[model samples]
Target: MIPFRFLHAADLHLDSRFAGLAHLPAAVRSYLRESTFAALGRLICLAIKENVDFVVISGDIYDVSDASLQGQLRFQEALKELGEQGIPVFLIHGNHDPLDGPRLVAEMPEHVTVFGGDAPGYATAHRRRDGQEVAIVSGISYPTAKVTANTAVTFSRKPGSELFHIALLHGNVDGDLQHETYSPCSRKDLIGQGFDYWALGHIHKRSILYEKPYIVYPGNIQGRSVKETGPKGCYVVDVRENGEAALQFHELDIVRWQVTELSIDGMEHEAQWVEAVERRIEDIREADPHLMTVVRFRLTGRGNVHRLLAEKGAAADLLSELQRREALRAERKEYPGLVWTEGFAVESGLAVDRSRLLQEDSFLGEMLRLAEKGEGEGSREELEDIISSAIAPLMENRELRRLLSQVSEEEKLDWLRGAAELGITLLSGLEGAGEAEGGFRDKPDGGRYDED
Candidate 1:
């Protein structure tokens, strides 16, 4: 039996536009761009430190269809470092990095073996220490961006070989929703192929669908958005003598994306709100001190701060001031190693006084009544259209739009409360009676009337 270790990594997304990252401070932006290569360098260092036999990069090394020469050279230099240390590297092209275009890996070091986008291809190598031959790999690359049929059907375990077999594939498994069915295959298909390990890629979230043949995704080395939060990186697998494997995740991501929600309901002033936000930030920093975070905050609840948040430009200004103060604090060694707060999303505003609105028989009240009636008697589509139109102005407003986009659970509950109040007030007004002065009053005919 041949015992060996290997590093598996995928979805580098190198040189991709840091779209939302522009809001970050200049130093953070610089770190983000450079962090992709730095993570790859770290992966190489890990491989060298662990004395792995070879490194397998499943796919998507670069983000652009036409990759930059500088990016290619940077990757080449890192791979060269591994080659100089007598370690071999193998790779396959994924959907993002197809093979029909200019080959980026063409001038790579001799130790690098890239499987081209052609018919079934495989590689055989021997372990130098034990002189034991091993069927190291088999794979197919994406010829073009779209591949509808299964690419794995073409590959089979090497015949008449006593060595342990492994297959490297860059395709979506049957259940993945985010990826196209490019090079699609199934767990059953891979397990029946007699391969010992299947290194898979194209999905940015790491997963292990099957363990019998060891099918796995190493996920992306770095997260690009809030959706891809938490620790992001590759995996290190140790293949034992009896064909068993042990997998360990290694986080190589330098920049982290975090979403945090802070409630300002009980807090009386903006200073308290800032302190609350700072406390939350400090908590996250202590939990993951090395992380460079892109945090999104949702400040909510009914309080004096809520009125301030309702005013135009006030919420944004307050958030900016808070971030500036925190940044300054970080600079003064009060909170050392703290990265910039990328951006602030206010998911808070003044809780609507629906009862007050209904009492006045205003246009908003009429709209709410119409919405409720439509919801009860109208078709689903009609009801949806009515509600959407009723909320159109709020959605169109830039500040409200931003707030609603990242609304927290408490904000949602507040909205529900407002809705309930509106419903009750509308019901009361329908009981017709003469107007009175402030609050709701009962008329002689057993009806309730709202006072103006």
Candidate 2:
């Protein structure tokens, strides 16, 4: 029986432009630009530190359309770093970087083994620590960019020995709408293959499908967009001869992109709002001491500043205040670390639980009732779509296709509550109009009067 360790990482998506983030502070932008390389460096460093038997990168080494030569060269350097440690790198071309890949000018290292061809390819490597054969890894590179067939169908048929059989695949196991469903397969398709472990890529969020055979998706090495908020990194898997493998995740992102929501409830003045936001920046700096941070603030809950926030230039003023705070930090030589406030939104309403209005029998109550329709299972998803598409054009960030994913999580997608308050604002603007709900609205999210 042989025991070994390996690093499973995927969806490098290197040389990404990281578009839609230009408005962030220059320092944050610069850190983000270099964050991918830093993350990859961390992965290599970990492999070297753990003396892993081998490293497997499932797919999407670089973006085919936007990949740069510099990105390729840097990638080569990282692989070379791993190669120097006698760490065999097993990689496959994902949809982003197909077999007939872009950025072909860069040279790959000799120690790196890329599984090519449409058919699943098998490669075997011995443990660097011992001479014994460690594991047989199987992988298939996407020949072309637009592969629609089930790539896993080939995995079931791929040949491998009894020793820890690991399969590297870059495809959607199920019908996940978030990403392009290339090389589609099923969880049953993977677990049923009897492979000792499956390192999956293509999806950006980390997930573990099953444990018996050890199927995993390490997610992207770096968080490239706001939708990719939270800690982003790779996983280290340790396998024993005849036991369940132990897995640990390590954070490798150089910067953290977080959306911090502040409640202005009980606050009285504009100065209080600035002071509160400043405190949040300080808190983030304390928590993520070394890493740069880009934050998008959302004001929620009952507040005196609701109308102030809704003003045309209110968001701009808040942005300036944050920038001024950063400048003061630099002047006073305080945490000089980079913590930036990119943008913000106002979701707060009158100092009242608007749901109570829904139960009323008046015009405003009727509006609340109609707005609450989307909260139910019958109309929630429909309403979500309508709001997302309607305001999709007004959004400053164009990377995300939907509003909900960009703004908040599923459980907290209660922006509908704020919609009720906004309806009141619109209704007030309508000069006592009995009813409202028509005409074009250019504001982000939705129209105020269109609600109540």
Candidate 3:
């Protein structure tokens, strides 16, 4: 029986510049681009400190098509240090670094073995102190960028052997959505091969598909964008003599990206809105001081501020003020850094008068009645067409159309409710003849252009 530990990592995307990082503060942009290599250094240090048996990099060690010679040399230098300590490194080339052209494997340390894209291969390493031998790893690289068939079937575990077996693959599992369908293989397909563990890559989010045989994705070593938020890192797996494996996640990302939403529905004053936004930023920074957040705020519900936000130059002025406050806070060291707020996507507007419309004996009223009939035993499509035709003229009206466009989906629904309420009030107040022409009366609450 033998005990060993290994670090499973994927999607390093090293030496990659995030073009979007330019939107962030200069300090933050520097951190994101430089931190990736720094995190890789930490990973190597951790492996040395933990005295792990080996390191398995599933794929995408570098982002460049042909990685810089300096970058290649630096990587080889790190591998050389591990080789000096008698630790072996197993690696596979992912889509980002396909095997067919401009190879760097030749420059790496002798202890590092890279699997070629042509065929599946494995390397054997021995536990010196105990004299127990284990199959260190097996994998195949991407011959070209796209692999549509099963790469797992080409790999088979050693025959009639009880030694620990692990397969490193840089491809998609049966149902991963974030990545293209590359080197597609099923969980059953891998299990049938009798491997003890499957190291997967291509998906940036970390996940554990099965624990019994330990199929896992260590996620991306760093968060590249808003989409890749939260803690990004690798997994350290400890395989015991009894075949029971224990896994622990280690934070390998130096910089992170996060999304937070702020609601400005009830905020009536600019000061109050600023205060609320400041509070939210503080909360986010406190949660993760190293986080570079991209906020997408939604201002919903009915409020006077909605009208102000709707005015020309008002929204732009608010964004500028918010940016100034964020900068000040960051300068004072109150918050880590506000990358940039995508914007306060507002969804607020004036209430509509619906009661008056319902009381009218016009075509609009008849359409509203049909709409209110609800999803009954009728053709929903036909009823929707009628309702659409009825509302088309109003929707096409320039002022109403502009207001509707300014508000959010939910706020538009609220405006519809207001129209219904007003229609009801006018209907109750009108006599027979007056009610007939009520639908076209130029909006009693000071016309459609009124401040309300």
Compare the candidates by TM-score and give the number of the best one: 2
Best-performing candidate as measured by lDDT: 2
lDDT of each candidate versus the true structure: 0.68, 0.73, 0.68
TM-score, prediction 3: 0.72
**Candidate 1 vs. true structure, TM-score:** 0.73
TM-score: which is higher, 2 or 3? 2
Candidate 3 local lDDT, 233-316, one digit each (tens): 999988888887899999877667555545555667767766876677667667666555545455544444555555543555
TM-score of each: 0.73, 0.81, 0.72
Give the residue spans of candidate 3 off by over 4 A. Answer: 21-26, 103-106, 128-131, 290-304, 307-452
Q: What is the lDDT of candidate 2?
A: 0.73
lDDT of 3 at 48: 84
lDDT of 3 at 310: 59
User: Under the 3 Å rule for N, CA and C atoms, how many clashes does model 2 have?
Assistant: 1
**Residue-wise lDDT of candidate 2 within 1-452, one digit each (tens)?**
58888899998877666655444446445556777888888888888987788999999888664468888889988888888889989999888888776565645677888898668778776878666887888898888887889877677533435678889999987766678879889888887787888999998889998888888998888877555678888888988878469999988887676777888797667778878888888899888887767677777665555556654356567788677766565455343366767566665554554666667777888867766665666775767675666576666565454433545435334556555667765653433222222222212233221100
Query: What's the CA RMSD of model 1 in angstroms?
Result: 12.4
